[model samples]
Target: MQQPEPLIPLAVPPDWQDAGSAILGGDGVRRVLVLGAPDAGKSSFCRLVLQQASRRGRPASLLDVDLGQKQLGPPACVTLGLADAAGGVPGLCALSFQGSLEPLAAWPRLIPGTARLAAAAPPGLLLVNTSGLLKGAGRRLKAAKIAALRPDLLVAIGADAALEAVLADHPHIPVRRLARPAQAVRKGGNRRRRLRAEAFAAYFAPAPAWPIDLAGLRMEQAGVTPWPAPRQLVALLDGAGHDLALALVEAPDEPHRLRLRAPRVESPVAGLRWGGLWLDPGWNAHEIPRPPRA
Candidate 1:
């Protein structure tokens, strides 16, 4: 028998034009949900949509829900960015800290946090980019968000059978199925970890240590977890309980005082929320226990 040639992945996704037309077809599209497995070209599709929207002179925003590999902002966060009409560079307007990179472990906060950020986005076409987690609880997490956010359009990349269950639950939402990009290459576990570490390091590259007085500030954990401790990640929240920025807790500089290494936070830090995971000096996240309640 003659041998057939091996298939090679192309550098560009074949369905880009089709996907673009399906997503940006009409002016009625307010919210779009992009779902797919890892390396399925979801982010690339988002960039394409943003560029098209800018060219069309329509205001657009992106709500990124990918905690592990973010397209808009830092890792372990759900961020909202407004597309610059002139420059095409999205600017971070708001963010909510989920703290865990694993979607399965962070779904409890992910669903609600996504909705909150989406709601806070400016009036325009809102494109939501999700993490590449389409199995088991990850699939369920996407379905729950679909129910919660009630997006106007659902963009599903790849032909995973698991997506059927997710799409089946929401028949009213229009779905645009696109083939997985030929150039998509799966990332290994170690590479993912390394990428996360690199993201964290870059986020805190110019961080300066700030000594905060913990006398009257509210400090609490997201769920059942330990109180704010050294080397753990913490969210600096405003009076409205919105995350201003991420900070690393450091050993107390003085009695009843807390120190943090974080970016410059212009907003006044009214509260402190203990993030779900901890990071070492290298910014690699370490999972903590979610102990049973009493």
Candidate 2:
């Protein structure tokens, strides 16, 4: 693959100059994963990289694995897009994982979904935008993800002293630290909820409520046990278990059929799996309330 071209002369800010040159220079960096705390400007930096590529005649795709505060796809899904730097968030291809706000509970699905998205991305500069969960188990998930993707470059957007221990194992990979953009805004709970709601609304629009037979499709990553509860969020998947669409289990109509509200699908669905997400009619995620005693 042709090494991605460097930013057009004087196009990048002084802060990102070295990193940009490093990525576009010597041997050429093909894959990169940008890490940072919440509101640390990871996505902002991603836009810069794509902008440079756009101006220099280089092609690139961005793989966004952040389930919340999503820019490309719905909440709880890992999505990718061939970006237009000037256009901002582009058309998305999604792989639905666990749809909760936090990624910790969905590590099993997140890692594989990330890897699959990375592998499927078109050849060029593949810039990965990660979530802001950067402490404790979140750190471990980051470590595991690095090990799995084996990116060509690791860019940390802020003070990464906490990442030193986990990064110790990968001495061969180079890491670039960039200061968080001063203009980046820190999102509050209400803002986060609003953004997540917008993403979910985009997913549920237009498609009429549809009922599907649970027996016709197979389920994988179906969680620890089968759930028969109402209003639980379930994922419609392909035979290989990629997300085809998301639905609410309105009710169990029979032993093998479910009443649901889901987006229409163009292809046949091969699996029905629930991620324990209890979504209200608006598709906003909520805690699964206790089951009433029989």
Best model number under lDDT: 1
Candidate 2 accuracy as TM-score: 0.82
Clash counts per candidate, in order, are 0, 0
Model 1, residue 277: distance off in Å is: 1.9
Residues 161-249, candidate 1, lDDT per residue (tens digit)? Answer: 87777888789889888888767778798987887777677666668898998888888677456567788888899998888988888
Which window of ten consecutive residues has the lowest lDDT sum in model 2? 1-10
Clashing pairs in 1: none
Q: Whose TM-score is greatest here? A: 1
Give each prediction's root-mean-square deviation over alpha carbons: 6.4, 5.6
After superposition, candidate 1 runs with Cα above 4 Å error: 1-11, 85-89, 223-225, 289-294
Using all chains and alpha carbons, the TM-scores for the candidates as numbered come to: 0.88, 0.82
In model 1, the worst 10-residue window by lDDT is 1-10
